[model samples]
Target: MPERIRVLHVEDNPDHALLIRRSLEREDDSLEITSAASAEEALGLLEENGFHVILSDYALGSGMSGLDFLRAVRDRGHDIPFVILTGQGNEEVASEALRMGANDYIIKRSGLLQFKRVALTIRNQRETFRARREKEEVEARYRHLVENVNAGIALARGDRFVYVNPKLCEILGYSAEELTSRPFLDFVAPASRETVAERYRKRQAGEELPSTYDVWALHKDGREICLELTASVIRDSEGISTLAVLREVTRERETERRAQRMEETLDLVFRQAGEAIFIHDLEGRIIEANPAASRLTGYTREELCSMRVQDLHVPEEREFSENKLASARLDGLFGFVGTGRCKDGTIKRCAVTTSLVRMGERTLVLSLVKEVPERMTSHEEEWVAAAVDARLKAALEKAPMVAVQAYDRQGRVTYWNRASEELYGFAREEAMGKTLYQLILEAAEAEGFLQELRRVWESCTPAPGREWLTRDREGNRRWVYSTIVPVVQGEECV
Candidate 1:
């Protein structure tokens, strides 16, 4: 059901009041009428009851007239719509009532037409008041929201500050009165002023660009602040203006710059380092090769990056390289001596240190390959070495009882089989490239051992088996029967 309108009807004559009520109810039954013969009685009823509309006599019998009553209600901030009634149906009196803030006015007549007209005026008055009140409430809430929001909001005409919210004033450290009538670019840092102006000019010229970006701004105290500003062009009745929302991004932007600087530093180190570094993905495809790595392989950096780890391995070492890579993925770190094919189709020897590393979301391998002296003289020599290496690998892994070892011409242990590891109490990996006699003989026995080794090398003869005392890895003296034989490689004892 529709809500009934509450109306206060004020008139001096009882007959006129009855005529107005009966005529109004006959046409529309929605009006709930209350009687007041004088403005004084109407004021009392107004204090107690909330009426949506009010009808009053133009001239009251007591107290003030209807126009005076309307002024009083408005002065007291009452939200009731008051209409006036005149006995003579004169336009002059109706005009005077409306001029004094009466929502509407009606002229008394002998027929019921005046009653219907007054009912319509009351309905119109109620609707207009309700709409006006709601509009005011919405504006109040909007003003509060803009004032308290964190993002700074501002309006500009050309370069001048036209309007700014409280948040904008707070951000700039200025009062609204101080900021208004000032050039907006005055707050921009000197270094960023031209860039800001150019963007604004392009926007006004209808050119498309980024609507939001970072810029440097200045505070009232002359501190430089980074601002991320989003702006748009607004064409209003007055002219074209710019509306902007900005926030401080100093911390966030500086963090990004610091991260970029760190990346640059790391890249510089990688390019300038002495170690050969190759970075590849989990699938063995080379992603990056440092200058040292490229130089050692006799390939340009771009050429090396386009090749896979296996591509650089010598044909015979390809399987070994691939298997080592797969094993490194599981172990995270691995190393092995590999014969690689260089760019000029020559054999290059290197010991590669490979490790798995994580960069952001991708898994990669970072390898450091150090070049070792080439021992093979030709392809035929390499094939012979490869075959010997195969048998040597089996003996190192499967035969721990027979101590088989090899030494270079410099008297450094090049290969230590598994049997040597068990007999000497030092793993093969720990004994490679170490001076043989120093690792096994004590200081007191070192001189005699060197004399014996030199004699065996020069004589090309095998020394008789002799019981000798040697030190283990723990420096404990132990007894073993040892024979020395001169091993020759390429006309040299090795």
Candidate 2:
């Protein structure tokens, strides 16, 4: 339902007021009329109520005329349309009334007949004012949104920029006028233009794509900035236009690239490590091994893959190997000195270290085996004799000096020199195969020295400057200093 139009009629004659009321009511049944007899009465009514249209007689009882009333209404900020009614119709008076802000003028004698037309004209004027106000309001909201948004926003047609917000200007270091007059592609760095064009074409085809991608954009000052761009098509009723948003992501992209390079370098190092490294599961089976492992163990990669960790240790040391693996799993690290049997039945002394490594959902044992050459030469005969001769010469030249000997685990004389003959009254050949304990009878009785020596031999640890009392071959007891060290011959323990 339409709202009723309210009419305020101000006339000095009662007949004229009644005629105006009847004409407006006949034209629009919903018209509500309010009457005032003089200009003063009209002003009072205006101050008290709201009206959509006002009609006033040009001669409003002398002092306060229709022109005066029109000025007063406008001065008070009332926007209602004011129509003038004149008893003495004259072109001069009508023109003056119009200049003084009258919306329309009609002769009193014929005014009632044109009431509908006058009412419609006034209604149209009001609607025009309302539409202007709404347009201004919408424009204000749009400006506010564009100025305050964080992302760089732009509207473009073909290659030219139609609109660019302050954020877009700030991002490119350009004024709004400067940006709008130029081609939109001018801001895109040359290297990235083709890729950006491809994405734009996809967007035009109505395909949805991820908004964020790495691209280079040129600023007004010619500096390049990495950007992440997102855009959507904006069309009117005819369907053709576009708006774009851009965000700077230079720092993020650089960081990601650096991290990727670091990961690649680390991967290369792990694959090409120089030392033998083996990874085994808790069950003692080799899960992964570096290339160095294959060369060090004298086994093909396939053969090593099939071999259990226990197979690397001497057969008698398998139980010890299992215990070490168990300890490493429980305590994280275990260190042991052991004999490793190579693929060719040759045993090598090694210091083995084991650690548990947790990778994702699985646990692995990492082993590092370092070859101990000095402890694996015990079975070489010629090298033992040569080492004994060298030591004897050094000891005999420095008489009464500490005697150092190398012995096998069974206590056989692996090294015998001139110093031992002078100190124990036995020739080098006589002491060659005899146990030092028999040459010096007190060797076994003095402070458990023989037992300690045996332990040192088995452990392959050097025992130096140990003072003990010993009986010579002739039954003479003497105090002497002795040291024992395992001898390595040709890189093997003897």
Candidate 3:
């Protein structure tokens, strides 16, 4: 069953009121009618009951007229739909009632036809009133949401802002009136004006483009602010427009730029450092190594990354290195002289410095290794002097037919004779403190030379003499017979 419409009917005559009630009930059973003998009585009923529709006689026989009653109801905040009933030839009066806020008017007649029309009018008026009230409620909710939403909102039409929400005014540092009165591009930074204009034109033309992007905007105070906007085209009865939501991203972009600059600076320093630097985890596994570290260890960067820090130390020095690392972890920093075993199996005397540092949640070790000369103690000097004849050393230094050069375990020049300088086109001063690979050998040949030297160092004996096609500093290739031998002091090979 449909909900009953509550109708308050005000009439002077009882018979006429009965006739209207019977006719309306015959036409539609959904109406519930209550009669009032006078306008004053109808006012009392209105106060006591909630009625959906009001029907009143144009000429009430007492206190107030129909027009007067309509005015009173409206003044009292009752927005019920009201219909005026007037006699034939009273069209002028009905029009006047309508102007006074009457919803509709019906001609009075002595039949059921006029009352039937009244019933239909009541249903139509009720629906109209409900629709109007529902529209009002929806508009209130929309206004509240748009006003309180966190992001800035704007409606743009014909290159100007048709509407700007309060949040948008706050973001742009302008009043709502100022924002709406000016062209939207006036507030856009010069750098972004062209882009904003192009996107607007394309969107109005119905072109598919990215809906969200970042743009620089000018604030009221002349400062530039980055805003990330999400926009869409809206086409309605009022024509095409663009609705946009914006959020400020200035801080986020600044942070990203700073991070990028810091990374670039660190990379430049890492590449230019002279001493070998290594970063390893608590387990002594190498994580990162600079170019100098790779060259010093005679290993490719990728190969070193896969090895442990302890793996770079000579077998006899590994336990000592481990103890130093443990002490560095507890004390924050430690330094010692240790021997590093290169990939070619030769050992280098390095002054090792280790520091414990934290990166986020992980504690890491940063190690710096610089090559140093190996000095012999008195006992070791005595042992070495007893092993080598001073006459043979002097003879070899003065030999003109042979180019004899000796390198420390790290492949750095320890001794370069006059004949060696002529053969390699490098003076003794230029060759000293320089790696043999850097002085005369090409990168491809350095590995083979290191391998030969490794054989002599590991076995503590002379390597078999071999023929090598080497390059001079002037790019001339020369063949020479080379022999690699290790010098031992006591039990340790240098």
Index of the highest-lDDT prediction: 3
In candidate 1, which residue pairs clash? Answer: none
- Lowest lDDT 10-residue stretch of candidate 2: 387-396
The estimated TM-scores of all candidates read 0.61, 0.46, 0.67
lDDT of 1 by residue, 89-129 (tens): 47897898778778787777766676778888888888898
For model 3, how does the per-residue alpha-carbon lDDT over 1-494 read when each residue is reduced to its tens digit?
88899999998899989988878887989999999988889999999998999999988886788888889998999989999999899999999988888899998777666777889999999999999999999999998998899989999999899988898888889998999888999999999999999999998999999999999999999899999999999999999999999999876676566456646766666677776888898788998999999889999889999998888888887788688767655554445666788888888877666665555567788777777667867565454433332324444576544677888777788889888888889999999989867887878788888877777778866676566768888889866666675555444566
Question: Candidate 1 at 459: error in angstroms?
Answer: 64
Q: What Cα-based lDDT does every candidate model obtain?
A: 0.78, 0.72, 0.82
Please, what are the lDDT tens digits per residue for candidate 2 over residues 1-494? 87777778888889978877787787777678899988889999998988877878778777688888888988888867787877664768778888887778876555555787756655665566567778989999988998789978887767677888888888889999988877777788999999888887777778898866778999888889898877779878746677777778765676566446645764454457555667899879988777777767888778888878899999899998888777655655445567788888878776655665555567688776656564445454334434433432442344333344555666667676666677777877777776766677554463376677676656644455345667878898765544554443323335
lDDT of 1: 0.78
